[model samples]
Structure formats: C-alpha cells, structure tokens
Target: MKPFNTGHEELVHDVAYDFYGRRIATCSSDTTVKVFDRNDSTGEWDLSDSWKAHDASIIKVCWANPEFGKVLATCSHDSTIKVWEENIREKQNSGKRWKRVATITDHKGPIYDLAFSPSHCGLKLASISTDGQFKIHEALDPNAIGSWTNIFETNTLSSAPSRQLQSSFCLSWGKSRFSKEYVVACALEQSYIYQRQENGKYTQTGQLPAHGSIIRDISWAPSIGRGYQLIATACKDGFVRIFKIEEPVTEGGNLQVSLINQFDDHKGDVWRVSWNLTGTILSSAGDDGRVRLWKSTYNKEFQCVGIVSAEQKHDAIED
Candidate 1:
C-alpha cells in the first residue's frame, strides 16, 4: 500500500472521505484539519487546504452528501462541533477555501464522534459526547446555508437513573433509507438503540449487552430494502461483535436484537469497525495495529477473510 505523510505536528485522530471518495479530510491532535484532493490524471493525493479547526484536539470529521454542496462537520475536545462549507471564488489564485458556517456548543465535554445522515434523511447531523449527551441537529432549510436548528438533546442513559454508568463514547446511524430514525449508541458496557418519534423526539427502543469493557466504535450496515438490520461494534475487550436487528411484524412494534457473530482475533483494544458498501463484509482495527476483514460464508457464519498489518504504527483505517 502507498503511504502518504499527513504533515501534522501531532497524531492524526480521524480521516473522512467525501461521498464520491474524490476528496479526503483529516483531523489531528494538532488542532488542525487538512483536506486532500485526488489527482485524476496522476492518481496521487495532494493537499488542497489546511487550517486550524479548533482550539483543542480535533476528534472526528464527517462529510455530508454532495447534493448539499461540499460540507464538513467536525467535533473537537474543545467541547464544540462546527460545520464548514467550501466556497469557490472566481479568481484563479483564490481557488477554493473552507468557511465556518455554524458552530454547536451544546456538549459540556469533549465530543467523541459526529455523523451526517444518509442523503435520503435530508440534512441531519448527530453527535455524541463524553458529557453523557446525544444531540441531533437539522438544517432549518436544506436550500439555505448556515441555518441549523437544534432538534433534540437527551441524556445517554439506557438504564435507570440510579444505574447510570460512564459517558457515552460512540454512535452510528442506521443506513437504511427506509428508516430515518434508527441509531445505536454505546457507553461503558451496553449499547442502546433509539428511534425517533413522530413528535420529533427519540425513544429507547432496544439495548444490546456489548462487551465487558468500553466500546470504542460502532457501525450500522446500509439496508438497501433488506428485511433485517445489521450492526458491528468494536470494544476495549479486544473483540468485534455483530448483531442483527429484526423488526416486529405488526405496526408500532418493538425490535428484536440477537448476536450474529463475534471475533476475538485482535489481541488488543479494537478501536473501529466498518461495513462495506453492500454490507456484505466487515473490517476492524485497533491497538494491535492490524486490519482484519470478515465475511459471511454459505453456512451463514462469519469468518476472517484477510488481515493487513501496517508497516509502521497506524491508528485506524476506514473502508
């Protein structure tokens, strides 16, 4: 594999690719975010823009749908989330520059992860924080820029108030175009599924006992009109687990969640898990510094298909 230096003074925390994979954005502990564009002719990536994005370490960056123009959302340890828009000027030398559109300061602690909804979900964004809060924001008008409304914010507690454990760490939106309200969040040792209500509020619909330790990452597979839902999660217990969510038949029914498969091949904390475009394969990485790919077999069992070890130290990789 070809390796490219990011030129960050500190460790890079996260990298995100645009919908088309034509542009790449990377955030770092250096409090900077850099964008890279892939050269169509030479097939090499070149730095397009670099700027200070936050006062503290930037944790994550996510790209919105191209239909909404070139937009990016970033979360930082400064307890803020910012949305940026790409502005193209007429002057040749000016080229393209990113401008901050909106800044959200609802979280009282460091924001761990942020994600934009699928294109079919309109312009919505979700963020999870160490303050034990989960928030959802929507663009007031999709045709208008920089106009966002704080839609919802609720405590990330699936258990009773007395049993509140640790801060919520990670969350993932279900990629089903048919269902826009499904999201899964993981805290200390449990993962809870939340579904948006008709009144624009979210309710805890289901819960999955994830791991003995903290969960680092979670990903929901894209359901292209599939009957069931699939979710993959990585945890500090050095394991990767997949769960299947089956909906009840009758109207306004509850969800049925079951563990489909799990892998303990990683010897250290598993940091991230992602599903392929078709939702057929899964990839995971962690402190072991190796990327493992798993696929389902004809017998309906999941098995490791391949492993890619980094030549040097690498933190995470996405599909």
Candidate 2:
C-alpha cells in the first residue's frame, strides 16, 4: 500500500479510525478535521468531509461507539474539547454536515490527548493535558449531543505544579468490559491508576513503578477473558515497558502492579504503544521511525515478532 497524503495545511497531529475501521478521522495543526471514507465501490479511501474544528491546533481526535451515531471528540491547544456529531437529516453540504454539539471549557491548558470510554460505560470521554490534569465528560442525553457534563476531573500529580512545564501528557481508559471504572493517567515521569468508588468519585489506587524518564504514550490492553490487566508505556528514555495489574480480591482494594518487561530495542524515545484486539500482540513506535511488534509466547514471555517503520501515555507520580 502506498502512502496517501492527508491534505492538511499543517502537520497532521493524529489519525483515528472509527469504531468499524471503515472511516478515518484526522486532526491537524491547521485546526481542522478531515474525514476519509473507504469507497466500497472503488476500494480506496476518499476525503468525504473537511471542517474547521477548533481555535488552536487540534491535537487528537476519537470516535465514539457506533451506538452513539457518528460522533467525534476533539481536543486542542486552545484548552477545550469539542464534540461533533454528523447531521444525518438529508444534508446537502458535505462540509457542514458535521456540527459542533458541545464545547467543553473546563481545562486550564492545552489538552494533548483524549479517549472515549468502553461502550458499556456509556458515552464518556477521558482527556489529559499539559496542565497536569485529567478529566472525564459524559453525554447525559444521547439525542442531544450538546448535553455534556463533567463527571470527573483530577490532577495527575499529587500536587499542582509550581510553574508551567513542557510535558507530553496522556491517558488511557481500562479496556475491559468486566473491570470496574478506572483510568491510568501519566504526567511527567510517573503514572497512576484511578478507580471510581461507590459514591460517584474516583480515587488513586496504584502506580506503575519502572521509569526514570517521561512517558509519551500509554495503552491498556483488553482483558476479554484474561485473568490479569496489561498496560504498555512508551517512554522518552528509549524503552517500552509493560506492567501487569492483578485483579484485587475485593472491590475498593489496592491494585497490585509490577513491571512485566522492558525492551530497549527501540534505542530512542518511544512515542506510541498499542495492543492488538486480543491483547496478544503489542506494538511500539519510537523516535527512530520504526514500529516493532512484540508477541507473547506460550510460556507468556514477549518476543519481538516484527518491525516496521513509523506507526503508532501519560505522566505518573508517587508519594
């Protein structure tokens, strides 16, 4: 497959595939979003709609579950998250078909990343920012996309920063249907896991403990019927590490986390880490412009299975 150029005026920040992988959404420094549709008739992707999305560079874009219709959540350097929904009522202009439904102005600084919650959790979106904070917003009324409420917000670090910092803040939701409400967010060099309580609030539960450098990205693997939870992190120190968080014996108990493995094969800052649908394969992308795949053997040890060029978390703190 050849590389198809995304026609944006500035550098593209992020590219996200919709729920079914049939539609592609891209956000760019040009402060706009363009949707590409896979042309079933031609077996090629075509730019179907493009629209100005934010006041500043749009850094990340994500699609909601199909149960919510064609909805998109975008965050930007403008310090806000805007929700967009496709207007399907006999629309004539393709560009104007996607309308902004909610403008969330609850963050203090640039929002770097955002992810929608698992489908069972309803339409909740989690976001992390350079301000050292993470927030979760929910759509109260599915029909009225504009009805968004801030359900949870907390600083990633134990204390507020004394001054502004240059950090690649990011967050990932727990990707398991059977797990309790939880999210893992990272700020500078540390990452912490937060779990919701019975009283409608979230509290810090555990921490990932194997990094001396800042984290650039994070991904929580899907559990399915697995017994444990896995999280992969891309670190600025040129290593990719996976941690295992064992399920607690009781609800509201402390989660046990230990570093599973660390790979320095990238030899440069790793910027992205993701897991396959079954959580069996792990992929890491680094500053060296290479994507390496890691798969677990029958004995449960990870080995590099493949490497490709250019593909694919957060800050954590401790007491």
The most accurate candidate by TM-score is 2
Each prediction's whole-model lDDT (CA): 0.84, 0.86
Per-candidate TM-scores read: 0.91, 0.92
For model 1, residues 84-140, the per-residue Cα lDDT tens digits are 998766222233388899998878888888999887777998888775688888996
Give me the runs in candidate 1 sitting further than 4 Å from their true place: 90-96, 157-168, 312-319
Model number with the top lDDT: 2
Residue 72, candidate 2: C-alpha displacement in angstroms = 0.2
State the displacement of the C-alpha of residue 211, model 2, in Å, after optimal TM-score superposition. 1.6
